[model samples]
Target: MRIIGRALAAMVLLVTAAVAGAVEEDGYELWMRYRPLDKAAQSALQPRATALVYSGTASPTAQAAISELQRGFGGMLGKVPAADTQLRNGAIVLATPASMPELAKGLEALGSEGYQLRSTVVQGKKLTVIAANSDKGLLYGAFALLRAVGTGAKLDALNTSSAPKLQLRLLNHWDNLDRTVERGYAGESIWDWWRLPDIRDRRYTDYARANASLGINGTVLNNVNSKPEILTAPWIAKAAAVADVLRPYGIKVYLSARWSTPLELKETKTADPLAPEVAEWWTRKADEIYRAIPDFGGFLVKANSEGQPGPQDYHRSHADGANMLARAVAPYKGIVMWRAFVYAHEKPVDRARQAYDEFKPLDGTFLPNVMVQVKNGAIDFQPREPFHPLFGAMPKTPLMMEFQITKEYLGFSTHMAYLGAMYEETLREDTQQKPGGFTVAQVLEDKDHGQRLTGMAGVANIGSERNWSGSHFDQANWYAYGRLAWDPQASARELAREWAAQTFTPDPRVTGPVVDMMMLSREAVVNYMTPIGLHHLMGTGHHHGPAPWVDSLGRPDWNPVYYHKADRQGVGFDRTATGSDALAQYAAPIARQYADPRTTPAKYLLWFHHLPWDYAMPSGRTLWAEMIAHYDQGVGEAKDLRARWEKLKPFIDARRHEDTANLLDVQVKEAQWWRDACIAYFQSVSGKALPQGVKAPARTLDYYKSLHFPYAPGRG
Candidate 1:
């Protein structure tokens, strides 16, 4: 036993050393790396920093803020600031306005959760004041300052005040308890639940640090298809340990609750929302969880969706179920995030319209503490999708936008598709509701209409991979999600530049081409996979490759044929008044715009209307010709991405550069595969010969249809 124990101790030591060593070597450190700045940047930053003085009491958050400042300063300038009670020359002071009363006067406009950073003199000493209304705000301000330093910004005359536009900026980890992540391309789940409660991994702390730096304050740690066992005593204890680690970073931990937990775990007769026993059980469970972790965020429930149990099983409304959970947690100031992604197979309506039909009626009925989380698009995370109808339809309910950061539909990290542009495109789209200008972001921010608490949630792609997110470029998606969550109006191009500069280097040559590649990456993937709003046309189950010919699934909604509706006459699902009338779900002005394919953006042409194959497009080409052109263009772009990456070989690390280069090779081949497979299948249905200059597919349509992938990753 002693020999075994010693061996384990040695293993632990070696692992710790390896992790610490990776801080310098691995790109997985993400944007948190406080590497020393260039000589010019160092000279510019050092003159403004002499000492660090934090006025607040030594709480965990305060300490973390100070530690981050020290780490950033020590690495960036080769100088660690001395922590002192009084400000000195060139000192940086961090404090909440309440902690330093005199400083409160100037920071009044920073708001309750906003932060202010200003250069000022204190008692004949020059100092940089980092002041906020709360400790969490102060910590966020510190991180912002560190980020500016890392990005080679001038700090001498800095005066910046910022706050999150959205209330709940969160990352929903689709991680199961058994360590397999749903749609996670990186690896197994990062949550080492087996060793938790007693032994916490340092990675958890770093994860919190990365999230907090981006102003993300909440995380749901489990998959939405929850397991009842997560509510057990052992799992609750494990969650508490993680909460303890994250508390300092101001990130509240949340869990996805299994709706039938009372029945599954406690041997109850029924899990009815109106039942006294079920209500009491949930209340007691909430009490138990709050007692273990004082600031437990709340629950994320995906009930009655894709086989999940819910109040509907007992002939009750969604509001009934959500209100029940809300009442249970309201006493503890916790909110319930009830998903709006519900659908029933029994319903004979369009799958895209189901969520809107179900939730629109329950708009004003939900409790204030309950938020109905809606996906960015009406359908599942497609390569491209029109903004969800619920974005503007729910005027009385607070809706949280849920975006999938994991590449479920966009080629799963193997293809470089930057989603920041996609997110921004969705948010900035004019819903055209009300008289004045109104966007999806405005719909979220319009608190007067009872859309009080706005939130943005990204399904996390992070796992235990050495590079954090499977591929080097994949890290940019995580970064982009956080930046947009903080400020939805942020430019995707600018965010890509910031990430590239910090992650790779600040060289214009390196960042310029990389950002260019990233900005167009998403469109390229869409072109190859589902251009012009074609969606869910991937291979069954795995969703890794193209299988546009798949039509034999069990249910109509489960089949790709139902979504594309490609036939001899035309292609695309008709959601306008002529078909399902799904377009009417949006506000009138926006609906009118999409009602006509001629006026609707070409990017979403097929999504809104089913057009003839030979219909004229804005590009002076027929729809079929345009489709062929897009596929050919996508293939060319993938080839260009490979060549551009080849040019960057000298600038990037050999390992990462080569890795990305090889992936681009796969991407190019797959792009051709998608083009050929889709063209062949569509041609077979339309019976149209290939347009001039568009080469015939090397393989027959039957060959593409016969392909199988039983062992594909992310198939659950």
Candidate 2:
């Protein structure tokens, strides 16, 4: 009996040791985790990935591609491939036409940044080839090869080609010099501003690798509310160090230029665009920057929005300010990204119309080097908004689409809301400006205009957190943003599937369910937070929780009450001719469609019209009851997200699975909090009883309204 007990204890100990040997991932690798594949997959890939042959010049970019392939093959197949000069069977050949003309045939059309992958025979040896026009394209091809294998593609049958539709794919970091990220829900800023240029973090290299994998070519290192000090020699040196690390990966560093830098630095008496001294100061500053970093991408200016100084303060047009800086950078072949998110201190009849009213007339006046960066929506980054009218309105001026990857208005980092659907919805929206089905994607690509400078910028959510993004799932948003930036017309659903397969196991059973969860995630947030076109109902200042009753803020548009305008009579702001005439900004077809409440899509019904509580919805329910139903439905979906994830636990490592499960718990509570508070406040105004099947608020209106978060994670 004693021997039997001892044997049982020994067996248990051996089992524990084996389980512990299987390391748990902390999500720091992101989607680039080239972990060992299953035995069958490894065996299948090993033959094709046995050797790497490069025929191009041994430049730094080519070396980077070689190193990445070795690292990926080593991890995925448990053996690094040998580098060989001679072509052989199962060799992965990388080349440009100048180096290996026969191997790179028909690859010239791919352009400098595009790549072609094929399985072909070269001199009687069947090999897989990665051919491009330049070293930058070779780097992209390397990542593509690894991505294909990591996502469970068969190597022997490889045949694909890819090119970025957009000219500039960038990540706009709102990181401050002090390391606080404005509207950033992650940890502190990843850029160690104080320690940079001398003591660079290895994480910077990883950041570049991740961005390069997604074809993102540029990064703005500071917040749009820029500091003049960034132009000083010390900060310029810091940016130069970051640029050195990213250059090999085909990325250029850009800065957010403070509009009044010359004036603030005391170099010029005024920052007026017309002033010769100010222009001279800008030219000298550009020269200094180019001296430090020769390939420096140019400036991203905020100018005249949210109290940031611009040419408007000097009684000049936006073009005047943009052209001044454009000329300064044009000498070095750099470009300027001038933002179009501007509004006045004094509120207009409709705040949404302010940007269009100011910039529409000045469309053709901007310099060729200047691209106007426009946010996806006319208003702030609401969960749901009509696509901005300026997409097609500015045909002569190049426009760059700006998307907020962080979830400031969509419940921050705690909630499990995937934003790919939101981005796709706006991209697919028809501007109806042309006769043959014009879309926002078409407007951005501008193929009709000869495919001139085009771009997409996502406000980065990266931070110093272990996972880079605040939460495990939040990393998907970053990945999706980059993929869509590379190709605006790419399907969000397909991107989500690719991300799921790479980030986790590539098994179809796991990826299918994960993609489904991501597909409906954004709509769930919309239902609970701001359903049916309602926008900006969050608490003032911090923007944390629900606060529909507070209307005492300084600016009328700053208050939540100003947006919903709820009363005993009805809810929603009227944007039609009957009210603010904001709808006139859209093309005539859309204006006509939204003129009547009956014709408008239900999702945007309240956004453009204020309907009575008793108005009949398509669902055969009153508007009041419909709103309540949406709130309840959203809460249920949040719970469903958790339940769906629970089933995935067996397939995922316990550490990441449990981390996501814990956040899902918080998300469920927050979703209920959003639902209950909104229903309670709107009910008070409507003076109506709860719908028959709906649950009443967990607490009173006073209890919900009394809550405050002065120390929220992203208060800046």
Q: Judged by TM-score, which candidate is best? A: 2
Global fold similarity of model 1 (TM-score):
0.95
TM-scores for all predictions? 0.95, 0.98
Worst 10 contiguous positions by lDDT, candidate 1: 19-28
Q: What residue runs in model 1 are displaced by over 4 Å at the alpha carbon?
A: 1-24, 449-451
lDDT of 2 by residue, 400-461 (tens): 99999999898888888899999999999999999977999989999977747999999999
lDDT at 135, model 1: 83
Indicate which candidate wins on lDDT: 2
Error of 1 at 5 (Å): 44
Q: What are the candidates' C-alpha RMSDs?
A: 5.4, 1.9
